[model samples]
Target: MSNLIYNEMIKMIRKKRLLVITLILIVLIPIFTYAQYKMLQNTIKNVGSSNWRTILQQQIVDQQNRLASSRVPEEYKHLIKLNIQQRQYYLDHNINPNAPGAPTFVRGFVEQGISLFLPLLVIILAADIVSSEHSLGTIKLLLTRPVPRWKILLSKYIALLLNISFVMILTILLCYLISGIIFGYKGWTFPVISGFQSKGEELITDYVHVLPQWKYILMAYGLAWFICIVIGTLSFMVSVLMKNTASSMGVMLAALISGNLLEQVAHSWPALKYSAFTHLRLTDYLAGNTSLIPGMSLPFSLTVLSAWAIVSLVIAFATFTRQDVLT
Candidate 1:
C-alpha cells in the first residue's frame, strides 16, 4: 500500500500538480499580504489613537449603531454580538483587542480562505485521481495485477490525503512568511480568546477559553483540513464514477462552489441543517460567530461532513469494485 501510494504520488508529481499548487500560492499569498497591508494602513491612518481599548470601544459603538437600526437581520445581529463580545473579552481581561502580526493575520485569512480557494486546489488534485487513470487505460493495467481493487482505490485516497495535508501546511507557512515580512513575526506567542459558545442569538460569554495564538491556529486549521478532506473524498467519488476529467472536475466544482451558494438558495430550508455544505463553514463556529445556517453547531457540522464522507467513500469503492473496465 505504501508503494502504491508512492507510485500515485509520483504520477501526481509528473503531472505538475505540485507546480500548479505552488503557482496558485504565488498569486494568492501576495494578495493576502496586500490586503492585510491595506487594512493595517487604514487602521493606523484613520483610528486617530493607537490604543487597543479605544479602537475596540469604537468598534462596539459601530456594532451598537447597526444593532439599533431596524434593518439588521436577527442572524447578522448574532454575528455582530459575537464580535462585540470578543472585543469586550479582550478589554475586560486587560488584554489588547488588537494584535496585528503574522499569526493573527494568517489566522484571519485561513478562516475565510478555506471556504473559498482551498476547495479548488483540493478538487484539482482529487477530481482527476481516478478518472484520468481510466481515460489513460492505466486503471485497467493496475486492476490486472493481483491486488484487490479496493487496495488500489485506498492507495489513491491516501495519496490524496497527503496532498491535502501538504497544501494546508504550505498555506500556513507561506501566509506567515510573506505576511511576517511586513507585519513582523511577533504574536505567535500571544494569547487568544476562543472556545466560544452561542445561546440563540447571543454568545455565552462565560464559557469561552483563552489559548496561545499558535494553538488556536492549529486547532482552526485542523478543523478546516477535515472539511477539505471531506470535500476531497466526495470529489474522488465523483471522479470514480466519471470517465473523463472534465465531468469529474465539473461535478466537484459544482459541489465546492454550491457550499457558498447554499447560503443564498437553501438557508430557509430547515433540512439544510443536514447538508454537508451547511457545516463547511465550521470556522464560523470557531470564530465566535453563528453558523452560516442558524442552529447548526460545530459537533453537528462535523458529524454531517463525516457522514457524507463515509457514504461517498462507500459508494465510490463499491461502485469501482464492480465497474467493468472494458467499456
Candidate 2:
C-alpha cells in the first residue's frame, strides 16, 4: 500500500498538473502584488503619510451618500452598507483598513483566489486522476497486479488529497512571498474585525470579536482547504466513472459552472441548499456572507459538503472495483 501510494504520487508529479498550477500562481501573484503595491503607493501619495483615518472617514461618508441616493440599486446599497460597517469597525477600533502591510493584501487576494481559481485548478487535477489511466490503457496494467481494485483506487484518492494540500500550501506561500516583498510584512498582529454576517438590509446581531491578522488567515484558509477537498473528491468520482480524461474534466467543470447558475436561479429551491456546490465558496462565510441567499450557515455548509464527499467516495470505490476493464 505504501509503495502504491508513493507510485501514485510520482505519477502525479510526472503528469505536470502541479507544475502548471505552480506556474500560474508564480505569474499571477507577482502581477497581483505589484498592482496592490501601486495602488497603495497611489493611496499614500493622495492621502500623504499617516492618513488612513482620513481615507476611512471619507469612505464612510461616500457610502452614506450612496445610501442616500434614490437611484442606487438594492444590491449596491447592501454592498455599500457592508463597506460602511467595515470602515466603521476600523474607525471605532483605531485600525486602518488600508494600512501599508502584507496582511491586508494577503487577506484580500486569498479570499478572491480561493473563491474561484484554486478550486478550478484542483478540479482539473482530480478530473484526470483515474480517467487518464483508462484512456491510456493503463488500468489493465494495474488490474493485473496483485493489489485489489479498491486499494488501487484508494491510492489515487490519497494522492489527490496530497496534491490538493500541496496546492493550498503553495498558494499561501506565494501570497506571503509576493505581498511581503511588495508591502513589508508588518501587521500580522494587527486586529481585523470580522463575523458581520448580513441578510439583505440587516446584519445579524451576533458577531465574532476582532481577531489578529494571522489567526483570521489561518481559519480562512482552513475553510478553503475543506472546500477544495470536497470539490476534488467529487471530481475524482467523475474521473472514475468516465472513460476519457477530457470527458471527466468536462463533466466536473460543467457541473461547477452549472452550480453557479442554479445558485442564481434556484437558491431558495428545496434542498438545493444541501448540494455541495452551493457551499463551494465557504470562504464567503468568513466575509460575513454566510449565503449568496438567506437560510445557509457555516455549519450547514460544512455538513452538506461532508455528506457530498462521503457519497462521492462510496461511488468512486464501488464503480472502480466493479467496472469491467476489458472491452
Candidate 3:
C-alpha cells in the first residue's frame, strides 16, 4: 500500500500538479495582499481614524441602515444583521477583529476563499487523478499487475488526500508570509471573539467566547481543510466516472458554480441544504455568519458534506474495482 501511494505521489510530482498549484498561489496571493492593504488604507482614509473600534461602529451603523431599508432583500438583511451582531460583540468586548496583522489576514483569506478559490485548487489536483490514467492508457498497465484494483484506487485516494493537505498548508503559509510583508507579522496573541450563532435573522450570543488569534486561525483552517477534502473526494469520483480529464474538471467546475448560484435561491429551494456545495462554506458557521439558507447549523452542514464524501468514495471504489480495463 505504501509503495502504491509513493508511486502515485511520484506520478503527481512528475505531472507538476503541485508545482502548478503553488505557482498559481504565488502569482495570486501577492495581488490579493496588495488589494487588502489598499482596502485597509482606504478605510482609514475615509473614516479619518485608524481605530478599529470606530471603524467597526461605523460599519455596524451602515449595515443597520441597510438592514432597515425596504429595498434590501430579506436574504441580505439576515447577513447584514449577522454582521452587525458580530461587530457589536467586538465593540462590547473591545476586541479588534481586523487587527492589522498577518494572522488576521490569514483568517480573512480563508473565509473569503473557502467557497471558491480553495475548492478550485482541489479540483485542479484531483480532476485528473483517475481520468489521466485512462487517458494515458496506463490503466491497462496498472490493472495487469497482480494487485487488487481496490488497492490501486485506495492508493490514489490516499495520495489525493495528502496533496489536498499540502495545498491547504501551502495556502496558509503563503497567505501569511505574503500578506505579512505589507501588514506586519504580529497579532498572534490578540483576542478573537467567536461563537456567534444565528437563529433566523437573530444573532445568538449565548455561546460567544474569545480565542487567541492563532487558535482562531487553526480552527478556521481546520474547517477549510474539511471542505477541501470533500471537494477533492467528489472530484476523484468524477475523475473515475469520466474518461477525459477536461470533462471531469468541467463537470466539477459547473457543479461548484451552480452551487454558488443556488445559494441565491436557497430559501426557495430548501433541499439545497442537502447539497455538498451549499455546505462548502463551513467556515462561515465558525465565524457566526448566517447561512443563505436557514436551518443550516454546523452539525447539519458537517453531516451533509460527510455524506456526500462517503457516498462519492463508495461510488468511485465500486466503479473502479468493477471496471473493465481490457476493453
The best candidate by TM-score is 3
Position 30, candidate 2: lDDT: 88
User: Backbone clashes in each candidate structure, one number apiece?
Assistant: 0, 0, 0
CA lDDT of each prediction against the hidden true structure: 0.83, 0.81, 0.90
- RMSD, each candidate, Å? 1.8, 2.6, 1.4
**lDDT tens digits by residue: candidate 3, 75-119:** 777788778887888898888888889988899999999999999
TM-score per prediction, in order, is 0.94, 0.89, 0.96
Write the number of the candidate with greater TM-score, choosing between 1 and 3: 3
How should the candidates be ordered by TM-score, best one leading?
3, 1, 2
Local error of candidate 2 at 143, Å?
1.2
Q: lDDT per residue, candidate 2, 85-173, as tens digits? A: 76676687797655667777777776876646777989877999998988999889988999988899999999999999999888888
Which prediction has the highest lDDT against the true structure? 3
**Candidate 1 lDDT, 1-327, residue by residue in tens:** 899999889888898887899888878888878887887677666777767777778778888899999999876777787778777777888776348789987788778877767888889889999999888888878899899989999998999999999989988988888888888889987888776777765667777777888998998899889988999999999999999999999988887778667755555787877777767776777767655466676677788899999999999999999998885
TM-score of candidate 3 against the unseen true structure: 0.96
Candidate 3 C-alpha error for residue 98, in Å:
0.5
Deviation in angstroms for 22 in model 1?
1.3
